[model samples]
Target: MEDDIYHVVREPEFTALFLLGADDLVETVEDVDAELRLPDGTRWSASFMTLGAVETVMNRWRETGEYGGGVFFRCSDLVIVPKGGVPAMIEAFRAIVADGPQETLGNLG
Candidate 1:
């Protein structure tokens, strides 16, 4: 993970910065771990995973004997999106934020 490189996107209400991995391609990335700065100067973190990406990870975990043999998928600060790419993720985050469900993301101190 290259912490220095970030994909910054500014929305009307918030600004999001995604940490890109060494081999990550922004246009095709299905899973992203991002930090969002809200209007109140508060930062929140969330992991956005597409349905397909979650299934793929679970299947791989089954083979590797992880996460109860891949029977269940759990993430503390997870926002599962229907599609891949950063745009979809940013949209989801925006929706979640606008809907007043801050619990969907973890607050960063």
Candidate 2:
């Protein structure tokens, strides 16, 4: 993907921009980094990873001798979504911010 490639999804209370690690085809993207900005200037960030993507990473780690031989997976700000694509990730983010806990995301500013 080109450096200028990005997807933006706006909501009533916030705007989400799918930034780094995004693919040209959003639907086929298995993992991506995004930023969520609230009306109050609060910024939050999280890496969105699908279940299959996480498993793939873990398997790769198991072969490369990383993360205790892929015994576990952890990230400071990770949002695991059931499906790929920016839309699904945005949905998950919305739910997380609406009904989930603050720990689900990392504060950017």
Indicate which candidate wins on lDDT: 1
Q: Which numbered prediction scores highest in TM-score against the true structure?
A: 1
C-alpha lDDT of residue 96 in model 2: 72
Q: Give the TM-score of candidate 1.
A: 0.89
| RMSD of each candidate relative to the true structure | 2.4, 2.9
Q: How far is candidate 1 from the true structure (C-alpha RMSD, Å)?
A: 2.4
TM-score of each model, in listed order: 0.89, 0.84
Give lDDT tens digits, candidate 2, residues 35-105. 88888888888888889999999999999999999999998899888888877887887797787436688
Give a tens-digit lDDT track for model 1, residues 59-95.
Answer: 9999999999999999999888888788888888888
Give the per-residue Cα lDDT of candidate 2 at 13.
69
Please report, in order, the local distance difference test score of every candidate based on alpha carbons: 0.85, 0.81
